[model samples]
Target chain A: MSPLSITSRTLAAALGGYGLASLSAMALAVTLPMARDQAVIIGIMVALLLCSGAAIWAFSARSAWRAWAGILAPGVLLGGLYLWGLPA
Target chain B: MNKSFRQSMAWLHTWTGLLLGWLLVAIFITGTSAYFREEITLWMQPEVHDSTLQPGTIDMALAALNAKAPDARSWDISLPGPRQTAAELRWQPAKPPEDGRRHRGEQILMDADSGEVVAPRATRGGNFFYRFHFELYGIDRLWARLLVCLATMFMLIAIISGVITHKKIFKDFFTFRPGKGQRSWLDAHNATAVLALPYHFMITYSGLLLFMTLIMPWGIDAAYENDRRSFFSEVFSRGEDAAQPGSPGEMVAIGPLIEQTETRFGKPVERIQITNPNRDNAQITLRVNRDPAVTDRQRGGDPTQVFQGNTGELIDTHIPANDPVSPGWRIYNFFTSVHMTRFADPLTRWLFFLFGVAGSAMTVTGMLLWVSKRTQQLRRDQQPDRALKMVNGLNMASITGLMLAIAAYFLANRLLPVTLAAREDREIQVFFIVWLVSLVHGLLRPNRHGWIEQVAAASLLWFAIPVVNIFTTASHLFTPLAWQHAAIASFDLVCLILAALGGHTLWRLQRKPLPAKARRAPAPRPFNTTNPASEQPAGESP
Candidate 1:
């Protein structure tokens, strides 16, 4: 099977992209020095934009593995940092 | 695997559009209708056709409420305004039952003049179409919302990719040739799309934005520790008040409070809510019905004002979102206003509805174009494929069949007995059953017969609505319609227009049968695949 088949791209975008967006939103919410309500609101907008970009990138990428890596690497880093010592 | 940007975008556009186009069409149609949902709901309930808004209506309503729910804890009176024909009144007891489905009170419609109960039909108001627009029926709210969001995202992707693929699309807007088979469809698709390009983009993006928090609430969940209410309180400043246990105090006249509220705000009041009525802790809250500004700031503008119930003295008031709003609330409200069109005037509402219909037409035409192209290919290589057959049937089912189902739904509302329990749910059930039957009808024929039959049925039903309304209710198309109650006449007119349009299209389809040009050779070969199936690939010409 081709590495950049539509099916693989879909999986990477939906799963990996979703994880990245979710993790980044949490990280921003915790780290931003603004009020929590403001931080969360801004974080959500950022996450949505990031998610849309990831989806577009997933389909446009030459290989599906790169799509997965592009999303999951940042996702895991933020997720790990969140787990370590991020404020609620 | 290797393709140019435009080619890749073309591929994405076709797939994404095909994958979610049916649902998109459904959403567009229902949502567009929801823009006129108030009119549709009024048409459905003919009981309040004569109850026009007049002077002294507020005083009458106040007297009615004071007499009806004297000992009640709270009184909420929504005076008749745009989209509403009657003064909607509700009151709550000090000790209320735990019923979340309905509002927290015994609700009833009060006539503006006499303050008599205007018992309209028990059907779900314009709320049905509005709710169905986002959260479709027969599903959990969360699940329905998520499904709609997913489809919306796919539609966004399709729109973006489509723009990329159609580089000279602007030129196509000015180019259209009638009577040419594929050219006509392309022209139609391009014309409708390009004409309402901005509206389509705005509506689609705002639709996605409307459900942003529900779609991406991780940040909110984390910040508020999964408590959504706290975030809501902080962002949207709801009028938080407490009721005290005090002895019964001399109640002040509501007419004075109403006068004071209107005078104080320099705007017409739409509703008033009295918490702890007739008690020392009573508070009167007045809501502005219409924003004086040409354009509304937020979805429901903060034109809410609270007054001391006993003294009729103003306590607090909130203006529109001009005040400081929490982080993303402004953007959220902007998108919401665009999507909901709640702030739109009648003319703007009509434009939105028309654009929505045009968008639906574009989707339907695109689907038909796809089928026609495939049919040509099938004729060139004559072997019946299951997928092509299924697509043909599904298109007929969703496009025209849904219209038939909506018509049937209206007919059911009039025919069903008012005394029947769960009549609203049953009416919805009738709608789905009729839709399901039409789908079966589509699968059975999938040709000229299917198209003609379903469109004809829908047209007849559209015509029959006004006829039935005249016979069953007081309102009709040709009757003398007053300006205040013009919605009823307008409803009838809209139906007549739909009937004429449907009839004209059906007549044209029957006269020409455009599909004949596309599927001349593959017309009757769906069932007979023995001899022709053998020599299928022999004459394959690209």
Candidate 2:
């Protein structure tokens, strides 16, 4: 792999993965019907797992672009959920 | 496709394990020592070693507190259990001074048996290690915690990728081929990692969870609308001390309350918190030793009995097992509590400590395996590159050099004059200085000589601790008082045990042939070193 490709994939794994995890946390926190505290905890816990999974996906993907796409797709979905669930 | 996936995972595991691996090793060692935090604190304060468990220890502690701070707003007495010898007495003054400066309440260590004040030397004790475990010393607290959280994330990823990369995890658990350089290190690494796989996973994941609020606050921010404090209040539910101080009045006897709470909980009371003491509305809350089996919420779940202090009337009772916790909170509490070993008995704490040792061994072997593998692949005539040499020196400093530094820290605790100003900071300085010296030593002599010398020096320092204790403090290894105080005795014994281990390692290193014989010939082809398939044995592929 080229140095540029590795660096791009690393950024995708770190920043993109963190972005995806944060989105998941926000989406679950707002959408889950449970109490806010419990929802927040469950969201963060699952988000951490998703972060690791994103890291693995970033490395295993055939191309760095695919890595970003894989992480961003779910992130976009979670962002939508978060926005829809937000209180006016 | 399967093979490629495994190879990529192997690649991921190697880098993730190597990058922050040194920091992870230091974190693991200190964090493991924190399991004995109270005991280490006890050992450091030799002035209280004679304060063994006695009947009516709580009564004496109360008497001391009442004499010291009779009109204080609150009185807290932490009675010594198995891991401590001193009754820690803390009292919050009635109010802030007229100048409105924050009044940090005064604390003093009293002999649990005698109730006489004991002034031990001023040192950070185990708190240094405990605080350094998460928020490292001498750095901004936020940055230190953030760095630690990042290393923890890397650890979580490393563990996951490592499992994916290992083709025969169970089979490798049973294998330990001795005397082959890289192969032996690999075997040790596999054995330790697989043996404590669950523990490693729990510790790393829970480590991240412990700092989840700081690291992953998005959920809380979204749900609570950026009100982090409200989220904590909701989760922890620490009710405000509502009752104001009433007129000064006689308080109830604490002895009966202690016995009553112990009988009710089937465990000895660990602490007594008296709010609005000597007032009409004085409240006494008795908390007993935590039962490890209880997987309740970490905060506010101890089995407690509250009494109207002046009236001696039972106000409320809390049995943690009877309390209902949400499933998510229960899971969170279980992992974080286990990681802290907060409720563990001595035996269980020891088991966790051993598991921590195994975790440390896993990282050490993994680091060694990396160096050994690269060294083995080195061409016979080609010298090691600068990066390899740098990593080798760092490995020495982080592993054995760190051992030497801790020994120096303990030695500084003993050697530094008890009356010296800023004594605790001085001890910490000694630790860092010795560690820095070892780093230079490692870089200068990153070879067989450096390992032998540093290991020998650490071993000597550890061995010297008990011997020096006899001359410096009354609670030496041979003293009867040492036996009476289990914490002090165990601390010295652990030192000796570690010293022996270091000695054994030194002996093994000496017996082994020099570096030349350890190195293998270059691989048959000019193998692409970056290829994961070329790194390990190829027989696993189907």
Report the number of the highest-DockQ candidate. Answer: 2
Candidate 1, B450-471: lDDT as tens digits:
7778889989998998888777
TM for candidate 1 is: 0.89
Candidate 1 per-residue lDDT, tens place, A1-88, comes to 2543878888887877777788878878777788988778677767766776677777776677777778888888888866753653
- Model 1: number of clashes? 0
Quote the lDDT for B474 in model 1: 64
Q: Which stretches of candidate 1 lie over 4 Å from their true place?
A: A1-4, A31-33, A73-85, B99-103, B225-227, B290-300, B380-384, B513-542
Give a tens-digit lDDT track for model 2, residues B1-542.
Answer: 23487888888889998899999999998988999888888888888888866787778888888898888888888888787778889888777566665456779998877779989999999999999989988899999999999999999999999998898999988998766566777889999999999999999999999999889999999999999999988887877854778998999888888889999989888889999988888999999866665367777778899999987889999888887789888889888989988778888999999999999999988888877677657555466677777787888888988889999999899999999999999999999999999999988777667778899999999999998998999998899999887778888999999999999888877775454432345544243333222222101101
Location of the lowest summed lDDT over 10 successive residues in candidate 1 chain B: B533-542
Error of 2 at B211 (Å): 0.6
Could you tell me the interface RMSD of model 2?
2.1
Tell me which residue pairs clash in candidate 1: none
Return the TM-scores of chain A for each candidate in numbered order.
Answer: 0.84, 0.96
